[model samples]
Target chain A: MADSTKKKITVLMVGNPNVGKSALFNRMTGANAMVSNYPGTTVDFTSGTLIEGRQEYEIIDVPGTYSLEPRDAAEEVAVRMIRDHPDAVVMIVFDATKIDRGLYIALEVMEQGMLCIVAVNMMDTAHDKKISVDTADLQKVLGVPVVATTATSGEGIRELAEQIRKAQVADLDKIIKRLNGEIPDKKSVGGCGGCGGC
Target chain B: MQKKLLELEFGERGVVREIRTSVHDLNCMGIRVDRELKMVTKQPIKGPVVVLLGEMQIAIGLDLAAQIIVDVIGKDA
Candidate 1:
C-alpha cells in the first residue's frame, strides 16, 4: 500500500501484444499480472502500486495494442486508458527484438503530447538473436529517457524506475531533425543531460 | 495453393494473401498481406492457433484465423 501523504504519480505501461508488458509491469509493481508468450493474454487493464526512492507510483498495466486505432474491444480499452489518464506518465515498453513494430505505436502515443519513457524489454532474446539496440541513440532521437531492460531477469529495472522523473513530451519535428542530423547531439554539450538526477 | 489460415496443418508454411475481416486488427498483430508465416500449432476444439511471424509467435483465435487467406508455400517434414 502507498502512503497517502506522498504524491502518487500515475504511470501507464503501454506496448504491443506479447512484448512482455505484463512481465515488466509485474516486475515493477510486484503485482501478479499473468505472463504468457501469446498475444491477447491481457485484455483488460490492471493497476498496482510501486514505491521507489520515496516516490510512489500508481502503475497501470494497459492492454497491449499495435496502434491507437481501436479495431477490437481490447484495443478500445487500451485507447480509453490513455485518454482517461491524461496526466499520467506513459511508459512505452518494446521488445528489443522487434523495435520497429513497437516504435509505430510509441510515436502514436507521443504524438498525443504526453510525458513518456521507453523500456526496451527482452534484452536476453535480442542478444540471442544478435540484435542490439543503442539506447543512447534512441534516447537522443526520441528526446526521452530510454532504458534497455530484461524484465524477466530484473536487469536495468532500477534505472528505469529512477528515470521516470525524466520523462519528456517528445517533439515530432525535433525528432525528425535529430534523426536527419540537422540538430547537434545534446549529450555533446550538456550538464547531466537534464536527467534531474544531478 | 491459397487456403484459409485456419485450414493450414501444423508446421505448414504460407504467405498471407488477404484478411477478410478486421484488417486493421490483423495488421496490428503483424498479419499483413505478403508476410510469410508458419503455422506452429493449432489447439483442438477450435481453440486459438499459433503462428510464427518472423521470430515472434502469435496466437490468434479460430474466427480470426479463418478470415486470413494464405498462399500455401510448403509443409515441414
Candidate 2:
C-alpha cells in the first residue's frame, strides 16, 4: 500500500547509435546502475536513478535506433518500449553534427504525445565541423526544452536535469493540430515499397 | 541488360535503373533512380559495397545492394 502511493518518475534516453547515450546514462546515474532486458525481448537495457531534492527519477537507456518504424529487432524493441511507456519522459540524444537525420526520429517521437526533451549531444564535435545550432531557435521550433550537451565532458548535464525536473506531458492535441498534415502515414513514409518486396 | 549493383566490378560504372528495396531508405542516403554511380570498393566475402555517387561515397549492404539494379551501358562513359 505504501509503494502504491509513492510517485516514481521514469525517463527514457533514446537516440541514434553512438550518440553518447550510454555515457550520459552513466554520468547521470553514477554508481546506482542496473541492467534488465526489455519486456518480451532478448535486448537488455540499463536503468538507474537520479535524485533531485525529494524526488527520484528512474532513467532507462533505450536501445539506439534510426527511426521508430521497427526496421529490425532492436528498433522493434525501441518502438515498443516508447509506445508502452506513455507516461515516461522521453529524452532524445541527438548528434549535433547530423541534426537533420536525427530530426527524422524526433518527429516520430513527438507525434506519440509523450513529454519530450531534446539533448543535442556531441556539441564539441559539431564545433570542430564548424556547424552551429541556435538552441533558442530550436526550442521555439520544437515547443519543448532543448539542451545542448557534450556527454563525454559532462557539459550541460546539470541544466538537463533541471529541465527534466520541469518537463511536462506534451500537449498532444495542440501538437497534432499545429503539425497537421506534417506527419506522414506509416505505410507511405519510410515503408518498403520501391519494388513491393518490403 | 539490367544487373545487380552487387555484380558490378570495382571501378565499373553503372546507372541505377530500379531499387527493389525501400526507396525511402535510398532517398535518405541521397540515392535516386537514373543516378550514375561507380563501384569504388567491395569488402571481402559478403560485406558492404562502396560506391561513388557524384562526390559522395556511400556504403550499402550486400543484401540491399543486390536489390539495386543498374544498367552498365559502358565503362565510365
Candidate 3:
C-alpha cells in the first residue's frame, strides 16, 4: 500500500483530449487563476496541489494525448513521463460516447506496471445514451478503482482523489489484451484538441 | 453580440483550458487560419453554440447545435 503522507507523490492527470483533464485539474487544484495566455498561447503541462480533509498531494496536468508514444514534441513529453514513471496514474477522461477508444489508453498505462484508477468520465453523456457501466465489473477487470464523472460538473472528482490515494500497483499483465493492439504510445496518434477539442 | 471564438472566453467565464479548430471549418469561413488554430462563424447563428476541440471556434447557434448534438453526440448522449 502506498502511504499518502510520507512520500512526495505526484498524481498525473491523463486521458484522451477534451475529456476534461484541465477541468479536473481546476477542480482538484483550484486553478481558477491564470486565464488567457495571448491568442496563440499553448502550454504543455501545469502543476497544482490538493489540500483536502487535512491531506495533501501534488497534481500535474500533463498535455492530453491518445497513446503513450511520442508522435510529436508536445505529446512526447507526456508519454515519456509516464514511461519514466511518475508516482501515480489516473486513466480516464475521453469521449464518453467513445468508450471503446477511451479504454485503449487505460490499457496502455496498465502495461507500464502502474497501479491505476480508471476514471469513467462523462456520465451525464452516458446517461443521455442510456449506458450504465458496471463500475464494479470495470474495477474487477481493470484491477483498479473506477469512478465515473462529468468533470465539468464535478460529479466524481472527490471519489477520483480518494481512489488515487488508495491506488496500488496491481498486476499489469492482466490488462495486456485490452490495449486494442496499441500501447501507451502517445506518439502513435493525432494532434491535440488542446487548441481545444480532444 | 459576438463574432469570434476569442469572444466566448471574454467576460466572467471559466478559465479557457483549450481551443480546437478545423481546416474544414476555416475554408467555409473564407478566413485563413494562418496559425495552427482559428475560429468560424455564420450568419443568423442558427446552430449549436459549441467550442470544437475547444479551438476551431464555430458558433453554429443553439438550435443547430442541439440538432447536431443529437446527431453527433446523441448516440453517446
Candidate 4:
C-alpha cells in the first residue's frame, strides 16, 4: 500500500545531545522514539514517515552531536548520517534555553550547503525558566524557516511540519551580514521577503 | 583539591581541571577544562553519573567520569 510514483523527501533531525530532538521527531512522525531527559539517550538514528501538504517525507532522527567533527561513536553516526544524505533537508533542533550551544552545530550543518530548517524545541521548559527565544529573529539570522515548538505538549508541531517545504540552504556570508546589521531588513524592502515565495 | 570527577559526592561542585582521555568526547558534552560542574546524582553499581553543566544536566558514564579531574569548589547546602 505504498505510493511508488511519489518521491519521498528525506529530512534529518540534527542537534546537540538532549535538545528534545527525539521528542520532536516523535511528535512530527507519530513514531515512538525513545525519549528521556538525559543526554545520549539516542545513540543511533530512527526513521519514520510523515505526510504533509500531500507530500510524503522520510524523517530520520539522527544521533545528537555538539559539532560536525566526530568526537565519539554517537557523534560519528551523526556525521555519517549527514554525509550519507547530502541532499536531505536538515531539521536542526535547539533547546530553547540553550540556543547558543545548539547554534554551533547548526552552523556546521549549514556550512555543508544543505537545505535547513530550525526547530526551537522545549519552549515550555524555557518559559518556566524565564527564557525566551525569538524564532523570527533566528529565522532572519539563519535565513531558514524557524519554528518554536514544545514537543511534549504537541505545541507548534503542525506549523513546523508545514514549514518543512519552506526550508532553504542558508548563505553563511548573508547570515554574517545580517548578524552584523550590514544587510537591511528584507521584509521592509518588500521584495520576496525571504518567505520562500509561499 | 583536584580529584576525579567520579569521586565527587552528590551535590558537590567543582571546576574541570583535566581530562585524561576522550577529550573531544567530554568537551562535546560540555565537560571542558575550566567549566564548572556540579554533581547531581550517581547511579549505584557504577552506572552513569549525572552532573550539572551550566543549566543543562549531563549523564556521563563512570569510565569517562574517572578520566576527568575537577578542582573542588565547595558544595550546595
lDDT of 2 by residue, B12-75 (tens): 8889999999986775455678888899999998889999876457899999999999998666
- TM-score, candidate 4, is 0.75
Q: What's the CA error at residue B47 for candidate 3, in Å?
A: 24
Residue-level error in angstroms, candidate 3, position A20:
0.9
Off by over 4 Å in 4: A1-5, A188-197, B1-54, B57-77
Alpha carbon lDDT at B77, candidate 1: 82
Docking class of 2: incorrect
Model 4 clashing-pair count: 0
Supply candidate 1's per-residue lDDT for B27.
Answer: 73
Model 2, stretches more than 4 Å misplaced?
Answer: A1-6, A31-43, A168-198, B1-20, B24-40, B44-46, B51-58, B66-77
* Model 2: per-residue Cα lDDT over A1-198, one tens digit each: 114345978999887666677777887888433323222222447788887655688888888777777667877778878988889999988878767656767766888878888899889988987889777556644667788998779999888887886554445564465457554433433632211112
lDDT of 4 by residue, A1-198 (tens): 335677889999999988999999999999999999888999989999999887899999999999889879999999999999998999999999887678878888999999999999999999999988888777877888998999999999999998998999989999999889998876535533364525
- In Å, residue B18's CA in model 4 sits off its true spot by 14
**Chain A TM-score, candidate 2?**
0.77
Worst 10 residues of 1 chain B by lDDT: B22-31
Relative to the real complex, the DockQ score for model 2 comes to: 0.22
Error of model 4, residue A29, in angstroms: 1.3
